[model samples]
Target chain A: MKQIFLCKDRLIFPWVRPIWVFLPLFILIMLPTWASEILSVSGFGTLGYQADNRSDVATIRDLSQRPKDGYATGPTWRLDSRLGVQIESRPDPRVDLVVQGLAYDHYKANLNNTITLAYAALRPTVNWNIRLGRLGYDAFLMADYRNVGYAYPWVRPPTEFYGWIPIFSVDGADAAYHFSGSDGIWSLKAQGGKSQVWMPINGGIGGGYHFKTDNLATLSASWQSASWRVKGAYSRFTSASDIPLLAPLQAGLAQVASANLPATSAQAADLLQHVSLEGARISYTTLGATYDDNTWLIQAEMGHTTATADIVPQGNMGYASLGRHFGAWMPFFTFSTYRPKSALNDTAYDLGATLNQGLRDPSVYMANSTRIDQHTLSVGVRWDFTPRAAFKVQLDTMRSHAPGCGLRSISPTLRTQDIHLNQLTATVDFIF
Target chain B: MRPLLTLLCCLGVCSVAMVQPTQAEVDVIVSPENPLRTVTASEVSDLYLGRTRSITEGGVSVAIRPYDMVDGLVRDAFFMNLNGMQINQVNAYWARLRFSGEVLQPSHLPDAQAMLDTVSHDHNAMGYVDATLVNDCVKILLRLGGGAHVPPSP
Candidate 1:
């Protein structure tokens, strides 16, 4: 993947604008005549709106988006809106070529993030599949398909589980072995690759961070019956976080450590590790299951992520949802939560109090910088009004616990506590 | 009592849904060159759901090319017989697999006659159509229904 700056304003392909979407649609109609045997084109999009609410903190769809207003000015459409087009060419039974370009509120308005997926697969035999190129991660249950709103029940997948971890696509290779028997179908997949992503900072006040993950590896297995599926995956990756906002803190810690003061030497060293995210190793393990009996849909997933760096918080997140279909309408309910393994580091606070005067403490904010805790209860309904389209409206009541503001972009001014806020969101999703 | 009431309401909806418009019998037809004489519903459903690309028939793994029709009624009836699924569930199921592009969906033809034309030309190709329309060009691998379903004629 090419390195793109978080503030790079230049479009990689200036001429490839939104108008170019029509060019493919025109080509799709004429394609059957030109290369009907090998070519296929399809697309999906969501027109969404987040209803206004009084939020003490700046709410974001995920870590990848920066809402325009830092203070809950009004309703936002870019929070949950996206359009994607996929082109697949299968010239032979054993070969597959796919390129999908998605347009969303990416951290960087660049083509690298716009063109999300481009991969090729080759089937050596009936039971073996080998793929290479830029592929979506198959770590979670809906990690790859979450962008396609029409494919899932909710307006968006639970943000607690997906917001903090934004590495969606990896540029590398994977192999899968599939076999089926009288009981069920089973598959084993192994993936290894490198990935780069820019996650947003403090909404509009702070910018974003461009981080790269090296030696990313994942192993996943699944067993599927006619109406039930169980999947589990384990992944490990190492990332170095170079945050410009925390540069002052890092330098301060380094200065204190270098001085070798007896009282603050160990504290400085530990706080330096807390402030710097260099050579951070993160491991994510997840287990998920789904049961869709054509009449009822039930899904649940639990994930635990651990990191070696104190700056990178270790945590657990999970969600369970149930939905039932009645003709063209489906009503659903979901509960999701995220709990950090450890609260704010007392060592950072102790060193910060030591650095600052005992009266006003900036280290208190430092202690609360990465601490996030929250749980949400959601009720939603989906109306499949047409064959190719669906309209969904969901109401989510969130409780942002004290000492943390969940996954919101963080700052001293926007730090909210133990407050409840209700958000209403609606989306019309379609695929063609 | 509340749980039972909820279950009763769900059963009532199911009972109402069971009353659907009658259609014709859909025959899962494949090329006569295919080695397998017949297939089970799960085997056919697996292909339709984009689960497996090939199946072992007569001790040999044979790659399959499934064909779908533009006629919505016959298509719905076929899946309804294969698995108790409506068209929306089927479409959403395929949509979930669309991003990976790992699962190969059955190519869509204009109508059943076009399906027959394509299936007859390829030994691996298979399709479903009105049982009355079956001819010597393709052999019946499975039968999905016995309704009076009339598909778009050639």
Candidate 2:
């Protein structure tokens, strides 16, 4: 009993947990003093819902809320809201300081807490700006701040492209520079640091653990003309866990149940080492266009990503939307889709190789290696009741399908079953 | 009844003829030294909406201020001809710009006299008021495309 107590005590460390809560507050309290001169505050939020057609799994129409599969037996969708305030201080004619705070709900099985976006930035020239702290990752065209509902033409972005990469916020440093072109404005950005990311929850027993990274780097460029905007970005990412070792062990387990091979500990350990998938290098490109004319507003976007590792499937996604303005109301509709590549081989393995043929062992299968297609259709309305305020309502219905061969052949029934889900959301957005 | 109606028509004509013809006219003005003689309605709309910053003879920056929301003369002579955007839509556009720190609302002028002072002082200024108030201080560039300017009554 004494040995057991010491063993547990050695692994526990409670002192480090409080620092995460106290550090951000200490910095926030210090801000209103030295930096209080030209402080300007701004805010944005979205309140929405999702209704799934399948009973076993509820569709997540709203990306802001917790997926039902990830939470306990509670409401399938609740008020997924976000609110942020930012301050901009210009001490001199040539220099300015910016600090921002963002809070949101992260619904887990038995957890409800608001994540904060604590970041600061400085700008000394019209062409150069630098920022540091817990901020957003530099993706192709989306601004983390501007990604709120008030800024976009649709209730949500097409899940096909924006949903594929899954990495959202970066807690690091970023710098950008802008130049002029005959066609429009051109800008370049480079960011690197430890990034915090979350992916869509998997329905399997154990899924979607909070993904953390130590080193993440990205380079991006954007150009905007009168009615068109295009952007391209590349990112290199690495994580603490090695994924290649997990895939084969899962495949081996699947084969043992069907092929009557004995499950041994040594066999599982060997397959884990041979099939470990880890450390991804990903590249992304995105293009968007909008026509703001007399009677209608139309927008379209397309994006694609290729990754070196099989952890994230290489794919392309896009959407098209149109909005018509009447006297006091603007009604719009959109459709978006995502497609994943069908193959997953690391250039060293063949279909009939020693590793591929050992499915009866406990270490050669991955659940997400197969090809899948997801699409969503949404209709929404925006009512500009006053000059400073607007109300929006949107409905999205989603459907997903997977191919029937290769890895999917290992579980034909699970691969062939297509599921449908729906989400409905409403928001009152304002700017002061 | 027919005879009575004819008598009233005659009486109306007599009154109209006896009264001095209050001459009502409309004109568009710019700087006297500006080389350009004419511009399209779309160009005026762009300037007023703050969509474009420069015009042919205008400087890099331009300021557009409607006389007032209550002014019938300004609406008939200027805004209606450019685009059908009502007063509310323009207000919404300005609100969006202000929050984004893009642009500010144009300065408002009270009457034709004040408007004349503004346009005459700044070469980039554009506005419309009573045509009868036009004087040598500013140059009238384009006549109102249509007829008599009684301006719609409130």
Candidate 3:
């Protein structure tokens, strides 16, 4: 007896309408034709459990809202459980199509299934290839299949470097050239596109930020030999976001500007101008290397980000891990760090006792919160129990020297104090 | 009764010996029509791993199709000597590349005869088999481990 009204249209259980519409359309698209063989279906999934002994909140990665309660406090399946399926059709030697869909808990509120990638690949020559559609970012190592746990060594890639750019896919095109030599193979790739970013806020209580990129361009090169690989990439993008939390700071700046306070208003205005999210440009450069000779594995990556916006702090992050394989078991240890260029300097906005504390406090807090100085040490073990499956256990200990900065989850009790979080995670990853 | 027990033990040992055949030498092979007669271990590894799909000889680029034994000790010994990697590691590597649309794993044949038949019929096809199974239809390019008896040319 329930009726849903959307505009002038009426429907029953409006949430179910999307399922009805897309399911049939998906089936129709998957049906085989004379030119296309049966659709090639492949999938990857992870079953994970984690526990943290520090705060009630679990900090999986940066951009995760705090104080909403942590999954590490209990046995939770929603933290890292995800499944992805990819369907590919190759009608000819020169052309192919692929569509991938992912179902994950952290996609966004009210959305559990989304199309992660849909692209058409064209090979004009044996050594050159082009792809158009929603494509994975080619900026960093493992960027293409970061979520597929079976492909990587870590239960999750070191969050220190991986969390810098949250956006994963770009809606555009890319071209790659491959060169083979006597000793190795080298590749150069260039991609350009725009993307939308969804960042969780307010401990994921239906609060988040949505950002749109004006344009993103990336160029990367990689060379791989029998036992060694090296990669480097550079990317730049301009983005704009309407974050509601910053509205108060903007209003305070305007108030002071109109109140005839020349000196205070000028400083506040400069701060506001730098922190504004409109048309802010961010550039990142990264280099990575790995050496794996079956028995030993060594990997290291360093990346630096330069941001024109004050709210987006400039920083460098890197990690190095060394692992050795002994039969079916591989054990590794890693060290990672994130250091922000801007320290917690709020003295510019102190503005003396003449100004209202309201105006000064918000500005000072915003500037101070941008400082991040943290390091993590982790050790893990991986057991390849089956041909297509692996079981991994990792222990990560993170220390935030800047207090409530970096990957630390800020609680009311730990706001002004340096914090350390210890987390242990176990995951079973499989690909089929 | 004692005589019968001894006979049963002897039969058991004989069956175990038959089932567990000694590891044999694996021979890299190609069709009799193939022009190339010699290949190195590294070249074979490159062709089988899909690192290079074709090789050039005498101004002609010949596309190579590789076939692998599905489950056998010879396949294991072949890969171990060529790349020092286990079958699982190779499978994992292929899986990682397959999902990205990068490279496809070689076709798998059930036994030595199937591999020999496929390689014998296609000039561009290449495979490995127990050296003892090599016949006049295919030409041996290289031998791995211990060499097997070669049949007389037709």
Compared with the true structure, all predictions reach lDDT values of: 0.75, 0.51, 0.69
lDDT of 1 by residue, A206-261 (tens): 77788777678999998888999899999998784567777777787788778887
Error of 2 at A214 (Å): 4.8
In the range A1-432, model 2's lDDT, one tens digit per residue, is: 746843663355221122264346535654664554444455555554434344454333222334444422233334445555545544433333444454554433221123334444555454566765555656645535333555554545555556444455566677877655654566688987665444333322334445555457888887654444566777776653443335545565435334534443344333333334344455666666666553687877777776654445557778888988764467999888777765433333332346456542222234343344777788988765544345677887767775411111122344446656566767665544
TM-score of 2: 0.61
Pairs with steric clashes in candidate 1:
B23-B147, B23-B148, B23-B149, B24-B147, B24-B148, B24-B149
Q: Which CAPRI category fits model 3?
A: incorrect
lDDT by residue (A1-432, candidate 3, tens digit) is 112323322153232223335434544655653245435677888898877776454575435322336322354555566788887766555566677777666535333126666676787766777987767778887666767778767788887887546566676788988777748878889998776656654354436677666468999998887777798999998874656777777787767766666587776666676556666888889999989898999999999998776667568989999999775568999999888776545676655575536666666556556556778899999776655677789999988765334554454345456778888889988877
Q: In angstroms, how far off is A301's CA in candidate 2? A: 1.7
Q: What's the candidate order when arranged by decreasing DockQ?
A: 1, 3, 2
Better of 1 and 2 by DockQ: 1
Ranking by lDDT: 1, 3, 2
Off by over 4 Å in 2: A1-37, A61-65, A68-79, A107-117, A198-208, A240-277, A343-372, A403-416, B1-154
**Among all candidates shown, the one with the greatest lDDT:** 1
Residue pairs whose backbone atoms clash in candidate 3: none
